[model samples]
Target: MLLEVKNLNTYYGESHVLQDMALSVDEGELVALLGRNGMGKSTALKSIMGLVKPKSGTVRFKDKDIAGYPPYKVARAGIGYVPEERRIFPNLPVLDNLAIGIKGGKIDAGNPDAWTVDRVFKHFPALKARSGQKGSHLSGGEQQMLAIGRSLMGNPELIMVDEPTEGLAPFLVMEVRDMLKDINKVGVSILFVEHNLKVAMSLAHRLYLMGKACLAFTGTVEELDAQPEIRAKYLEV
Candidate 1:
């Protein structure tokens, strides 16, 4: 497994947000997390990323325990996180934002596979043209692409994204969805939270549904399709 989280329990100022939550992601797998709003879907990702320290739980990546290690440490441990808000460096130009992801300034200048700024541009051509544009000046979809590109610069083995397509035009939604599919195709494992059932079913190899801070269901696309009641009860509002 590239990542394993077990018996995860987290709280937000005395409000219990996650209880015994468990999930896993293997190398190169695309995993989707589905749940309605306020069901702690974001909390689970935050806990794993060390953005919100869990009261008690396990967050293991690459066979090492990373629970409560802090966000920078988690990123250094081969996990990149893109929060729901798409926190880009609003004042920085797109190129500068991508530069920060070069962890410890250790990226080999000659490695082709390394996530150099040019590599990010090659993969996201739209961003290449906007290299000099500040993040705040970009369109919503452009911002999302920059955010993902910035994360990729870290050369992480896995990425945990929250609400990859929260607020955007329908066309942009499909574009971002396809972008994520292409990113996964390049061997970066993904665990993303999404409310769109169709998107989840289309992108994920497996699904995990959450409700009231607890895991309500886990299955493959075919299994989830066969069990419609699970969605009707836990997913449909």
Candidate 2:
């Protein structure tokens, strides 16, 4: 497994956010974590990335236990995280934003398949064209693209993206979906958190459904298609 979480429990102040949550992603697999808002999907990713300190759980990445490590440690261990908010430096140009994510100030010498600015631009041509534009000047889709591109510059083996196509137009949503597919095709594993069922069903190799802070279903896309009741109960609102 590239990533694993077992018996995970997390809290926010006094509020219980996750309970016995568990999931795994294999090498090079694109796994979708699906749920309505506040169902612990984002929390699960945060816990895995060490952005949230889980009260008790095992976040095992590459077979090493990394449950309580800090966020930087997690990133250096080859896990990239593109957060839900699309947090980019508002004043920084597109190229500069990408530059900030270069892991360890340079790609790991041990891993030659690392990404660079030119490589990132190749993947996101829109960003290349707007390299001189400040982050705040781009459209929503462009900002989302920059976020993913920036994460790629970190040379992570596995990338976790939250809400990649949340509020984009239909065309832009399709573009983002295809972009993710291409990213996966080039030997990067992806853990995606998405609300769009159409997008998830089309791209995911496997699916996990969350409800009330616990896993409700886990299977392939084909299996998910057969469980309309599960979808209606937890996903369709």
Off by over 4 Å in 2: 109-111
Positional deviation of residue 61's Cα in model 1 after best superposition, in angstroms: 0.9
Give all candidates' CA lDDT scores.
Answer: 0.90, 0.93
The TM-scores of all predictions, comma-separated, are 0.96, 0.97
For model 2, residues 1-237, the per-residue Cα lDDT tens digits are 989889999999998999999999999999999998889999999999999999998999998999999999999999999999999999999988998899778766686677988888888888889999999999999999999999999988999999999999999999999999999999899999999999999999999999898999999999999989999998964
Per-residue lDDT for 1-237 in model 1, tens only?
Answer: 999999999988879999999999999999999988899999999999988899898988999999999899999999999889998899999988888878886786676777888878877788999999999999888898898998998999999989988888888888889989998998899999998899899899999999788999998999999988898998863
Model 1 lDDT, residue 150, Cα: 88
Q: Candidate 2 vs. truth: CA RMSD?
A: 1.1
lDDT of 2: 0.93
